[model samples]
Target: MDFYLTALLQGLCFAGIAFGIYISMKIFNIPDITTDGSYTLGGVVSGAMLTHNLSGYLILPAVLLAGALAGALTGIIHTKLKINALLAGILVMTALYSVNLTILGRSNLPLLNMPNLFTLITFTTNINQNSLIILTGFVLVFTLLIGYLLKTDFGIAMRATGNSEPMIRALGVNTDRMKITGLALANALTALSGYLIVQLQGFADISMGIGIVIVGLGSVIIAETIINWLRITSVWWSLVLVMAGAVIFQFVLAFTLNIGIDANLLKLVTAVFVLLIVGLPRLTGRQA
Candidate 1:
């Protein structure tokens, strides 16, 4: 029961990345690779701040700000410089590698002793109970906030921009700004997930973000696949699918780990799962 609960909490943590992926892939129609680096960038910044005795409360917003800045820069390069969106994201991701290294001042930062949001919650009594409460709260608040944002006027504009850039531009919506805002918000969510993950796992390694974008993409793909089964077309339904997908993914991973599988094979398993999700539609003779 404890193990299952722990896996559930971890799944909720990864759901934030799924949300980020949805914003980029579905909302903005942008193939963003910056999430891979920006996630670590968030963790590095927050972990470094915490190591310096900074308040954990401040770390959350700080990580979000850092991610947003990184994403905005990517948007600027794409919009102002007329670079391709895919290339722009890659360039920013590449730059973030160095930036993250500088922030951490080395390869990794350990938060084993430093106070974090999780520690504060568990300070009084049962660690497991506090962890569950905090994780649940984080997931609920984030999902609700994202759901609300997607219903706002600006969110509608963003959806319009993604669905049809020319139409949005014709409507005087400032497509470039919408793209920037969407990317910033998306990456901020990704960074927040990373911040939470490091706190949960006890350390933040520089290489921890490797393949993060793929994992996020896989989560989104799996969510869409499942949502398709329900014939659900609403944006809120999509967000729910994202959460469900993350939980399912984590469950599969836990199952594999529990079966005494080699730890090094986890990445291979992730890759295979992604491939299967991506190929499911083709196998079923349906559009993906």
Candidate 2:
């Protein structure tokens, strides 16, 4: 039970990334590869701040701003410079590797014996319960805030830009700005996940975020599948479902690990699982 509970907490930590993936991929229709690098950037930034005895609350704004800056850089390169969106994300992601290392001044940073957010915000004496409560709160607040944003006029315009750029431009909406803002918002959420998880796991590694977008994408894909099956249309519910999807993905992975799957094989499992999730719908549509 404790193992599964830890997995649930892990899922909650990942809800931010899921939100990011939803904004960039599902909403903006862009493959933002910056997720991998920006995630580590968040961790490194958080880790560095933690070392300085800075309050966890104080460090978050900086982490978020850093992530937003990374995302906006990609957006600028893609929109202003006319580079492919995919390539722009790749470039920023690649550049962030060295930046993260430089910030940490090393390859890894340990938060052992350091005052971190999870402990600072806890309401209970039990470590597990504290983690669960804090992570749950973070995920809930973030999901609601993002869901509300998506339903607003500006957010609707961003969605429209993705759905039909030419149509939105004809309506006098600046599609480029929409894309840039959307990407910035997405990466900010991604950074929040890193900020939270570094404290949760007690260490931040330079390579921790390698291919993390897959985890976020898997959660989004899973939520999308369930939403389509249930025909759910409420924006809030869709966001909630995405959070549920994150939990489910983590639960499944935990089950796999518990069943004796080698840790190194987990990546392969993730790939195959995401592929199946992506492919099954196509197969069903073809049959229909």
Candidate 3:
């Protein structure tokens, strides 16, 4: 029960990153690996701010701006400089390592003694439940806002930019701006996930975010499967399913760990899980 609860809390925390990746990868078809760096950047920034007695609310905007700037850099490189999108993201991810380390002044920092958002909520002394409620509230608000945005003209244009870039460009849309805006929004959400996660786990390690993109990718893949099965077209329903997918993926990970897998092998397992997630759909289509 404890393991499952932890998984639930972790999943709720991850809901933001899942949404971020959904927008960047699924919506824009851009594999922005800057997620790996921007995630840790958030943790580093939030951890630093909290250690200095900054209000929890104040740290939120700081992390968002940091993540957005990191993402915007990748976007400008890819769009303005005509660099390969993958290369651009990789470059930023690599650079953010030094940036994060500089901000953190070390490889990692602990937040256990610091005042955080979780401690502010007095509803429940039980840490897990309180964290769950806070994360859920944040996720719900973001989901609604993003879902509503997707129904707007700009949102439709963004999707069109993803679905048919050339056609959208011919339609008098500035595809570069759309891509940059989407990446910025996506990274902002990713940073938010990192910010909350550092608080929840009580520490921010430079390595904490390594390969996290796979986790988000797995969640998105799972969400896509469910979306296809249900033929869910409404933006709201899609957001709900994607968030659910993040929870499901975490549950699966917890189950795997509970079955006695070595802790060091978690990344390997995550990779295999992503492979299966990415491969299974094709296998099914081929069988059909």
What value does the lDDT take at residue 210 in candidate 1? 89
Q: What is the C-alpha lDDT profile of model 3 across 1-288, one tens digit per residue?
A: 989999998898888889999999999999999999999998999999999998877899999999999999999999999999999999999999999999999887988988898998857888888887888898899899999999999999999999999999999999999999999999999998999899999999989889899878889988988788667788898899889989989998898899999989987887787777667767888321
lDDT of each: 0.86, 0.91, 0.90
How accurate locally is residue 111 in candidate 1, as Cα lDDT from 0 to 100? Answer: 85
Model 1: ten consecutive residues of lowest lDDT: 120-129
Instruction: Give the Å error, residue 60, model 1.
Output: 1.4
Q: Once superposed on the true structure, which residue ranges of model 1 sit more than 4 Å away at CA? A: 281-288
TM-score of each: 0.93, 0.96, 0.95
> Can you write out model 2's per-residue Cα lDDT over 157-209, one digit (the tens) per residue?
99999989999999999999999999999999999889988998999899999
By lDDT, the best candidate is 2
Q: Total clashing residue pairs per candidate?
A: 0, 0, 0
The sequence of per-residue lDDT tens digits that candidate 1 reaches over residues 1-288 is 677777888888888788988998888889988999889988898889888888876788899999999889888899899999999999999999999998899897778998888887663487767877898788888898998889999888988898999988998899988888889999999998888899888888899888888668878888988776566778777898898888888877888788888989997987788788778777887763
Arrange candidates by lDDT, descending: 2, 3, 1
Candidate 3 residue spans exceeding 4 A from truth: 275-288
What TM-score quantifies how close candidate 1 is to the native fold? 0.93
lDDT of 2: 0.91
Q: All predictions: root-mean-square deviation over Cα?
A: 1.9, 1.6, 1.8
